[model samples]
Target: MPAKIPATVVTGFLGAGKTTLIRHMLQNAQGKKIALIINEFGDLGVDGDILKGCGIETCTEDDIVELSNGCICCTVADDFIPTMETLLAREDKPDHIVIETSGLALPQPLVRAFNWPGISTQVTVDGVVTVVDGRAAHDGQFAHNVAAVDAQRAQDENLDHETPLSELFEDQVACADMIVVNKTDLLSADEATTLTGQLKSDARDGVQVVKAAMGALPVDVLLGQGIGAETDMAARHEHHHHYHHDDEDDHDHHHHDHDHDDFESFVVGRGEIEDADAFTAQVAKVINDHGILRLKGFIAVAGKPMRLTLQAVGPRIDTYFDQPFGDTPRATKLVVIGEAGLDHAAISAALQA
Candidate 1:
């Protein structure tokens, strides 16, 4: 029988640069063959495409699978195992596999799936690489405003017994063979150094700490760690929302001051954003309103022929052109996840304004 391929779990909070890091690995991947599984909590598959379009000649069309099934923390057994089997059965089996869990996911359950019957023989968990947003981590571990604080605190309390960012930071650190502090470019040299020290203090002893911006670490640093999946990761340490088993949730949800069920989701389809500033202002309003938690889509911006991608979680937003939209309409399509009974009309008006 062939040797079981080592699978790495790349996990982090929403918008913490997991996908960016993965893309870097794929493009610069050393001779090792790799397959990727991406799970996006958001409704769209923007992250999946970003990883797939690295222009790395090695990635085949079937090499990537995107799973957006509620929260993987609760649904991994249902979606993860079957998918792993499918990947292993491929004719050109990958030498290694990487699983990027949703921002809201917990790594423990996904790690446990390796022990499941039928699939363990073919694949093993190599390591858990957790990415942290250095800027957010240094901003007192949450957004800087009162509203951001209240929103994060409420989300923390309501989910996983209200796991605070500090605790969540600790949990991600405890379970990792390597803890990568990303977005170092957003911080000054001293700030990055200070945050690195704090992360080192929280990580398991002997764990390596790397400063990365846009997940730019060399491929070897990410892969070839050989951490092994069944390692008693629970011994490393500890750390979501009331979600459903399959698709949509049945419970009425609210976090902070907004009613969660009252949230609204709408797609803004404008072909090629002519003015980045205009689009940025519109997005700023949605996040500042505190009604939106996650925003993602491809933008057809003017002057830039490449497809401009947009992603925002809370007050932080990141954008870059990933690829041309090809023959499709060069319009921007975005999904806004906001509080229950969210004012869709208001958002639509602003986005189209």
Candidate 2:
């Protein structure tokens, strides 16, 4: 029997540089043939499109596949397994497979998919890498403030339930064979050390934590770990395990529907904007008012032929001209993801106004 092909699962929060790291890997793949499976949370293929635009010879458009049907973990049977089988059956099979999971995905469920009969014998999980935003971690974005949490607990013993973000972050850390603390450049030495310590404590013993700036890491370090993570599922903890069934027979029908009732995402379309500054300010206002976690998409400025790209994590918005509209319909389209119950009508009106 031939050896199983090695595959790496990259999981992280939104805007944690998963795509950047993948781009870096593709650029440095040397002579190895690598296949990429990109999973996105929303209807738009923003991350996948960004990766396809990387212009790397080793990982071209054909090498990259996007699964925007839903979260990869939830659609493992319907989408993930079929995709892996297709990749494995290729006459010119790839030397390795790299899966960039959606920001909202849990690594354990996806890892469990490798245990399926057809896939189990063909591909081995090289490693599970979890990337953490250094700045967000330091700023208590994912419930890092121990003192505050402790005080709240003391005030109300009933406040024992963890926030969705905290649980998600912890689950990713717990399942990681390697934890990459990315965006370290945004943090001071002391801040980085503190965040790293917190992550190390959350990770299982012997799991290595590496610091990186701008998702820069050697290809060798990220791959070839040979972790065989599927067998280690007993040791890796997950927050949603109770909601899952142990029987493989039930997995196909089990959706493992993620509890996303608190989150919402919607697309906002507009005609070409007359004032770029005004549109940006309106976006900032909406983000601030609604506590948006992520906002990104292309925009059509009245006079510019090139498309304007807008990305925001929290209140920080960055804009730049990525490329020409190129005959594609030029319009302002932004996908806003935030807490549920966001007034879409008000938001669209504000942006259009």
Candidate 3:
């Protein structure tokens, strides 16, 4: 006799501020219990760990599920379904649920997964929020027009099909209930306006496009969409199937397993950093030199009780401290991700140098 629980799906490309947006939402939940499911593509699972120790009173570690599946959408049957079921079965139910998808994930497959027999009856997708990097958008690094970017790929991949970056960007815009253009602070007035306009034009009619700095949007605006998005997939109109179904009854997953073949990630560990500024500059150099797509993890800074958390996408890097290292060993560990054929040994040497 109870109403279906509301769940918000936050989807975005690499370094689009999905995590920061979710952090802002959690910071302003106003005493509401919000359960978080973090889907990480790499082995380290740093994002979930970041939020787990984020010091948000409402989001305890117990309320967080650190899911390091190969791909969240690809493993819906084996991974996502049971995760959702487990959350709902808990005696102390959360007031709201937030699911953060991997950067490469296409929202359509994940949203469609919600229509499964067990999940559909219990959880309703409140809304799908797609975050875009405003600065990156302005620099022509990312785009919304599916047709335009369909054939694009990392310069050296030499693939015949669409690049995961382009496909993910296009599809994310198509499935969004709302689009958040983050990192506007790094963009000029005209740049922000132009990017927002392009996204609005590309998004579905009536889907609002909002600009943000550091993903700080009101909780009221972020949640409570009540779209029940699964039932409204007809209007969303996915840009690509990216998968195949044997029949109407067959689940759509892993049909396009090669989608991530071009990308790779690995962790680099080292001793504590004595000079954070110099170390950051070295990191920037490595990112630029090797064309690293994403680099994020914790650094043990000398004389600092709290470990430094660093996240980088493209040329932009952000750092902050969350919790202190009480008993855990002090070490600098980072996950370097980029297109396949990256010089892992060379990249690791550069970062660790």
Candidate 4:
């Protein structure tokens, strides 16, 4: 049998900088080919497009798969394994494969997928890297109270009895070989240190915690982590009552439930934003009103020729100009991912406000 190819799974909550970290690694990669499987939370494939825009020369069209119907970790056999097999069969096979699960995904199920039959002989579980939002952690986003709300948001009304976010946080931390505390730039030095200390306390002893800015980290540190699924599976806290072994078999149920009318992604591309503060205020209001989890895209602000890249996860928003628009039309193109029936007209009017 051939040596199993090493693959890394990147898991985190919404807007935790998983995609940014992967892009940085790809940009600074030392000639190693990588296959990126992006599990978008919604029905669209925007995340996959963002990954492709990262300019990784090695990753072709087939190398990327967007599992939008449901979380990839939960739908392993149906969503993950077949994608792995497809990548393996390609003539320009990647030396490494990275799977970025959705913000609401549980990493253990995805890690467990590596041990399944079909791809087990072909691929090895290298490690599970959990990207955490430093800003969010500092604000107690993982606290038990908010965790409860997040849990309710992730599932259908029927699953109101499932495990809470506090448990889910432990599950993610318990299963990780390393935790990348991303978006450190958003936190003060003291805040970052305190957050890191709290994270270390939650993580297993000696589970390395690295502070990252804009998801930038040494590629060597992210890859070849050698955290095999079979070796340290015991260290992970197993959730028995909520998710049963048979539950994996009924993945379609999760998908059907996942398609619930909770979240939707829409773009604002008509006009330029004249006031960043006013636009951000409107975004905050929208989030407060309809539970918008993420907002990201470039805003073409009036009087400023450069495009301002705007991103918001939870209540926190970050903005920076990546590059000049040059010849592209100065239009504000922002994608709002939030609950169903979000007042699109209100959102659009606010953007134009």
Candidate lDDT values, in order: 0.66, 0.73, 0.73, 0.67
Clashes of each: 20, 0, 0, 0
Model 3 ranges with Cα > 4 A deviation: 143-161, 243-353
Q: After superposition, how far is residue 46 of candidate 4 from its true place, in Å?
A: 1.6
- What digit string (tens of lDDT, one per residue) describes model 1 on residues 1-353? 97779899887665676776777677777667788887654455666666566567677658888776655566667877778888877788998898887434357767777887887787788788888878887887532232433332244322453445566556667777777877777899899889888877777755666777666676645675555656575576554233211111101211222121223466766656678867877787866774465577888887777888787644556788799777887678987764346577777777777
Predicted candidate 2 versus true structure: per-residue lDDT over 1-353, tens digit per residue: 98899999997765676777777677777778899998753354666666687677777787888876655666788988999988888898888899887434467888999999999999999889987777877786843243433332233222223445667678888899888887777788798878888887878875767777666676655776667899899988866631210000000111122333445778999889888888899899987877665688999998899999998755667889999999999899998876467888988787777
Model 2 is weakest, by summed lDDT over 10 consecutive residues, at 242-251
RMSD after CA superposition, every candidate: 17.8, 18.5, 17.5, 16.7
Of the two candidates 1 and 4, the one with more favorable lDDT, higher being better, is 4
lDDT (tens digit, per residue) of candidate 4 on 1-353: 66678898887665676777777677767888888887654444556776676556777666777766554655677766787778888887789998887434467777777777777787888878888878777786753134433542455332224565556666778878778887676889899889878887888764667777667666666786555765567788755423311001001111111122333678877577668888778877776665555677888888987889887654567788889999998887888765356788877676555
Winner by TM-score between candidate 3 and candidate 2? 3
Worst 10 contiguous positions by lDDT, candidate 3 = 245-254
Model 3's TM-score against the true structure: 0.63
Evaluate residue 80 in candidate 1 and report its C-alpha lDDT on the 0 to 100 scale: 75
Q: After superposition, how far is residue 307 of candidate 4 from its true place, in Å?
A: 53
Worst ten in a row by lDDT for model 1 = 244-253
lDDT of 2 at 132: 79
Candidate 1 regions exceeding 4 Å error are 142-161, 240-353
What is the number of residue pairs that collide in model 3? 0
